[model samples]
Target: MAEVRTVAIVEDDPIIGASLAQRFAIEGITTQWWRSGEEALAGFARHRPQVVVCDIRLPDLDGESLFGRSTRLLGPVPFLFITAFGDIEQAVRLVRAGA
Candidate 1:
């Protein structure tokens, strides 16, 4: 919200990813957009984003797993999970687990 330092977007959808990147750029929020779980992991470690915007279903690692790994590595940084999928169960589990 308030001038985010940096954000990592782990979204495989090209259109969504690009649109988010553009919007963040407009707000002067630096972003690193990764298309897969593997890429997101690598880039997350490298960039150390202040926040992460990730999709629930990824090509390699899936969002729940990625969120777990990211929390361990990043020390509880904020993560926002975006999903177009209709799987409400998984999302609810994550939310209840305090993800």
Candidate 2:
């Protein structure tokens, strides 16, 4: 994997999204933070990033759904899923799917 210069953040929570973007910015990484799956999907169609940090439960599509739908457009980009619910089954599924 090459050095990641940019990351796309898909998170509904304003605080978490802003914080992640801020931290990435501090490290001199460019970030495209989207508040919903629809918005992220649209942005992704325009430009795919090196990595994606997405919330498990989004406003429209869930993380898994978004991953499934974006795989073709995003290619082999890495995905990191976040969730407060701590669903082990979903985590296993995601890991198995190469998230």
Candidate number with greatest lDDT:
2
Model 1 TM-score (2 dp): 0.90
Report clashes for each candidate as comma-separated counts.
0, 0
**Model 2 TM-score?**
0.96
Question: RMSD of each candidate?
Answer: 1.6, 0.9
lDDT string, candidate 2, 1-99, tens digits: 589998999999999999999999999999999999999999999978999999999989888999988887787789998899858898899889889
Q: Where does candidate 2 have its weakest 10-residue lDDT segment?
A: 68-77
lDDT minimum window of 10 residues, candidate 1:
83-92
The positional error of residue 9 in candidate 2, measured at the CA in angstroms, is 0.3
After TM-score superposition, what is the CA distance of residue 44 in candidate 1 from its true location, in Å? 1.8
Global lDDT of each candidate: 0.87, 0.92
Residue 28 in candidate 1, Cα distance off native in Å:
1.0
